[model samples]
Target: MRDFTVPAEAGLRDAGLGAGTTIALPSGRIAYAERGAGPPVVFVHGLLVNANLWRNVVPTVADAGFRCIAPDWPLGAHQVPMPAEADLTPYGVADLIAEFLDELDLTDVTVVANDTGGALTQILMANHPQRLGRVVLTPCDAFEAFFPEPYTPLPKLVRLPGASWLASRLLRLPVVRRRPWAFGWLAKHGIPGEILDSYLSPIHDSREIRRDARRFIAGVDKKYTLGAAESLTGFRKPVLLVRAADDRIFPAQLFERLSAILPDARLITVADCWSFVPEDQPGELARLIVDFATDRRADVVEEEHGC
Candidate 1:
């Protein structure tokens, strides 16, 4: 574990995540920002986005007396690129997440994940549930819906020669990026220009970053998500499924199925939002997280005391 300074971006600064920290994992170093103190709440974001995805939600959760650790997972938008030999596959990334928790010695953690990150969290829960006390999964890929529709061709497309480079270059254009096929549909209200820039600049500027992105994209397969789904029934930990009322990407039925699968799970719907609930409903999301963590902790204490 090492402390480091990340170039302060306006988006991150405004989010008030405090100083950045880097943890050396077997795969590579992961950059993260943390705020507040007490029980840990780690934020995991999906592909093409970084820790900034939680910018609006972290402060509120942290202020509620939970230590919020948001990492820039190597999902294309991260500042630090992984080693050339690092495994960026879905299972490998899931292990990387487990390694992250172990390296930090974060026990009984509350993991909050969205988008592709939610799928990875499911994998972590199936394979590495020891550290996690509970999980909150917002809209994300699941079941056979991995990559979902319209975007399903991504894995095969990235395997094509120069596809990563061309895609990165095309995304640099504001019009192209804002198109429905790109990031436009992710957030209903739309992401701020600066924040969106922060999300895309890494892949657009660094060859290594593009390589990392390509590796992860090409490895997208539904088997990992399906396998996780199969194992979720045995995961006795509490889970909160936060579904978007108007999600254009992940269907509402995904959460419905998840609720049916998990032994202990609750499902709630948030209105007027798309896939990015943190962006569309940050305050509500934060409130839900804090309340769930608090309520679950209290329940545990009562059970321990036989109350």
Candidate 2:
């Protein structure tokens, strides 16, 4: 985005994809890429992560006879603005996504979302119904988190005065430095480095990244809690919960609450992965998607694709 000149084909760089597609909305911008030539499968990543988080699973989904559209929203968890006091609210972010979806007129689209993506996808389910076909939420953060875990430091620090500078410094620590490593390892479940680069390509430093993270945490109450929270009532979308068994960010209870509330929802625990399920269990995730979309026709997944 240094040039903001979109990398051609409307950001749809991949062949047979809408490489540089920019779906303009009222809020800010929606940078997206689409691939393959089958049904549309929309992807949304969590807070700081971009739509590129879906990079690992896109090809497999496309290979399974589905098109992929991954969109990057503004002010992500890693977007660090210089001022450092950006008011990033979940309702605001959710509003941005809802507007993006409505503007794009992408109806009957299947969704695969991780982290913040999972939360906003739920927002989409609550607000827009016709546009949804199937939803796969992985390693979600739709409810209250970032309170009692290691990441709690994130919210507390982000809100402090001039927090961006400190966040930038702290993220370079050995512990924080390993995030990219962990991120790479997760994506190793399916994608190659080139694709993984897209996932990590969003930031060059912490200052540029910290602002987004702060906003993501601060916005949660507004986005999902106050606004989108009440909207979750009587939701009937077909949801597949691809959970990370060991995810501390969003625990099992959250998934259980979702499974209990969602009229049609199933959960699958992905072992050996954190909150990043697409990267943790692509093959299994893909298989479940195929099964879920095809009405639990597990054999169809193996037979139709032989993947």
Candidate 3:
């Protein structure tokens, strides 16, 4: 696997997530950025993006006395590729997340997830809920909407030979990358060129990364999400379901269904954003996370003290 230093231009420094660290998991080496020293909060990003998705939100949460860990999951845009024998399926990736938390010995973790990451998080919550204290799910795939509408063809498309290569090449063009089918619908105000480059360059530059992407994409199935949704009622831990008020992809009914199913769930809708809530409303998202995490901790403390 290639060793990568956090680029100075990735805006990680500005986000207070300085330097990247590597962790050895059963799958392979994973690269992550972290900061702060309090309750642990892990950030999981979606396809074709890395930890940089949380760049604008990390600093504030870290400052709020929470340890923020953002890993560049092997989702095409990650700098490090998984081993050739690694399992990149939705179930496998969810296990990889459980492994990461176990390796770090992090308990009561507050998991904040976006996009495809949210689907993986749901799987993790279903299969491995021992370490998770609570969860924050922004607009993402759920129920039968795994990959959603315009994106439904992605799994099949990536299965075609050379499709991954063609996609990486096509995304290099500014016009193509900004199309609604591309990164355009995710954010409202548009991602910065530098940040977008950070997300796109890995797949374009590395054959192994493209291979990893293809494996993961080809393994996408809505059944995994449906299965997770079926088990959500058993996830008694607190959950914050965040809906983007103007999200064009994930509908409001998804969050409504989640709130109804999760035993201790609450739903909040944020205005003026699309699917990528972190990119469009980082400040508001961060505040909501910090409050949810800290407030839950306080409630636990009160119960422990018999107050």
Question: Which candidate comes out best when scored by TM-score?
Answer: 1
Look at candidate 1 and tell me the lDDT of residue 102: 95
Residue runs of model 3 more than 4 Å from their true location after superposition: 1-15
lDDT of 3 by residue, 1-307 (tens): 3245664434532355646777888889888888998999999999999888898899999999999999889988887789999999999999999999998999999999999999999999999999999999999999999989889999999988899999999998999988888998899988998888888888998999999999999999999999999999999999999999999889899999889999999899999999999999999999999999999999999999999
Better of 1 and 2 by TM-score: 1
Q: Would you list the rank order by lDDT, best first?
A: 1, 3, 2
Residues 177-239 of candidate 1 have per-residue lDDT tens digits of 878778989999989988888888889989999999999989999999999999999999999
Q: Report the poorest 10 consecutive residues by lDDT, candidate 3.
A: 7-16
Please give the clash total of every predicted structure, in order.
Answer: 0, 22, 0
Estimated TM-score for each candidate: 0.97, 0.75, 0.96
By lDDT, the better pick of 1 and 2 is 1
Q: Tell me the deviation in Å of residue 238 in model 2.
A: 0.7
Candidate 2 regions with alpha-carbon error over 4 angstroms:
1-5, 8-18, 75-88, 146-148, 173-175, 179-213, 226-229, 296-307
